[model samples]
Target: MRSKPFLTVAHRLAILAYIVVALFPLFWLLKVSVTPNDLLYSEGVRMWPSRATFEHYTFVIAHSAFPTFFKNSLIVAGSTAVAVTILASLAGYALSRFRFRAKYWIVALMLVTQMFPLVMLVAPIFKMLSPLGLTNSLTGLVIVYTAFNVPFATFLMQSFFDGIPRDLEEAAMIDGATQFVAFRQIILPLTLPGIAATLGFVFTAAWSELLFALMLISGNDAATFPVGLLTFVSKFSVDFGQMMAAGILALIPACLFFLLIQRYLVQGLTAGAVKG
Candidate 1:
């Protein structure tokens, strides 16, 4: 009985340790971004520099093509998230609530798509997109991101649907609501947490995607944030300070995006806690 408190204390300590470990990189990134170029190498090992300046941030914002990169990434990631969520919601509802022929095969096929290496697909995808005048375009990126994200997203939404009671939808239908009407009004509201989860997942995936962006977009005009970060690198040296500053800046939109959906995210975390 006395061991219970000890175990609880140990568990809390472990979680605290994990949080510190997980956040250490972000802390370091913030630390280094504000560290002046001179002090960066001179006092790189310090947890916080002796002196810090926002020169790196100023340079990244004022002099670089980061704004364009930021805009491109926002458009691609946002579009992909919305598109994936809408399609996944419909497909998931179908998979969860309805049984049809080839259902098993369809699920298996989606699983198979996830099995292959993304690296292997890069060359084929590039070749396919190149001739369509999409190699250096934002639309191309959105289409690609949506395709890659949909299968897993469908599975995610389907799980949420499965958690819902079919009786609710049936009752709605019995009250003269059509299946589509029941789904739109009665079911979708209850699945807000799942939709939030899917949006966050897909948005982050598209926002941080580098390999596809790097391969598909060669011009700076269409380049995403990840590709834009590479501009801070050159043959002679890497601009660590500016790069870190840009990285810190890049995190803002994603953080804000999550903040916007934080209520649903909290609900997602606490879902299924109590039974009525």
Candidate 2:
């Protein structure tokens, strides 16, 4: 009994430590954002600032192009996440339910695509998109992001589909429902966790993507938040406060996205446990 209590305490402490370690950077970013510029360096590693202000945030919102960047990022990431999830759901369902001669080769080809460094393909992708007038366009970024994310998202959804029992869909079909109806009304509801996970994964990827955005987008109007953040850097100095403020603001959509999906994620996990 004593040993069990000690183990429980140890587990709690370990989790607490991990949480602190993981969140310290974000905490620091928030800390710095609120800290006054004069006291930033002078504070010398204090956990909180003696004086805090919202001036940085105010400046970013009122005087900067951050709002535009935020809008562009929301549009790109939201569209890409929705597109990938839809495609991934269909592809994942097909892969999970069907046995075809080409399935192995198809999976292998996707795995091969992941094996190559993205940098190697950037030039070729650019060359291809340039001819189609997709360069520097949000549509181009969405296309690129969707293509890159769909394969992994498909695999994610497939694993979820595999976890569901075939008998569930079989029973639904026996009631005169079509396969598509069975999938839509029965199988999909059960795979909510997988769908939520895929959406969050793709959204986070599209939200933080920088390299492709930088390489393909040339002007400020089309810039996503990650690329927009670069505007804070100059040869002589960096705007640490404004940058941190923007970072915090950028975190809002992602935080809200996860919050919205978290309930479904939990329900999915619980359902899986019960099924198991």
Candidate 3:
């Protein structure tokens, strides 16, 4: 009995330590963002600054082009997540339910795509998109993001589908429902957690993407928030306070998105545990 109690305390302490390690950077970002410019360097190594101000946040919102960048990121990430989830759901259902000659090859091809470094394909992708007038457009970003995210999303959804029993769909079909109807009505509802997980994954990936956005987009008009953050750095000096403020702002959407889907994520985990 004493050993069991000690083990429980150790487990809790381990989890608390991990949480603090994971969140320390974000806490620092918040700390620096609020720190006044004069005190930034002077108060070095302090957990909190002597004085704090919202000027940095105000400047980022009003003086910078962050609003346009925010809008562009929202559009691109939202579109990519929706597109990837829809396509992945269909593909995942097929993979989970059917056995086809080409299925092995198809999965192999997707795995192979993931093997290559993205930097190697950047040139070829740029050449292909340039001719189609997609070089500096949000549509181009959405298309690329969707393509990159769908394969992984499909695999994720497939795992969730595999966890579900085939008997449910079979029962629905016995009641004169078509496979599509069974999938749409019965299977899908059970996979809410998986779907929410996929959406959050793709959205977070698309939102933080910087390399492709920087390479494909040329000007401020089409730039996403990741690229827009670079505007704070000039040849002479970098604006640490404003940059940190923008970083905090960039975190808001992702945090809210996860918060919105957190219940489903938890439900999915609980359901999986029960099923297992």
Q: What TM-score fits each model?
A: 0.95, 0.94, 0.95
**Candidate 3 structure quality by residue, lDDT tens digits, 100-121:** 9999999999888888888998
Cα deviation of 129 in candidate 3 (Å)? 0.4
What are the per-residue Cα lDDT tens digits for candidate 1 across 1-276? 356988899999999999999999999999999998888787648899999899999999999999999999999999999999999999999999999999999999999989988999999999999899989999999999999999999999999998888888898999999999999988898899999999999999999999999999999999999999999999999999999999999999999999998799678543453356
lDDT of 1 at 216: 95
Q: What is the lDDT of residue 6 in candidate 2?
A: 80
lDDT of 2 by residue, 181-225 (tens): 999999998899999999999999999999999999999999999
Q: Point out where model 1 deviates above 4 Å.
A: 1-8, 268-276
The alpha-carbon RMSD values of the candidates against the true structure, listed in the order shown, are 2.2, 2.0, 2.2
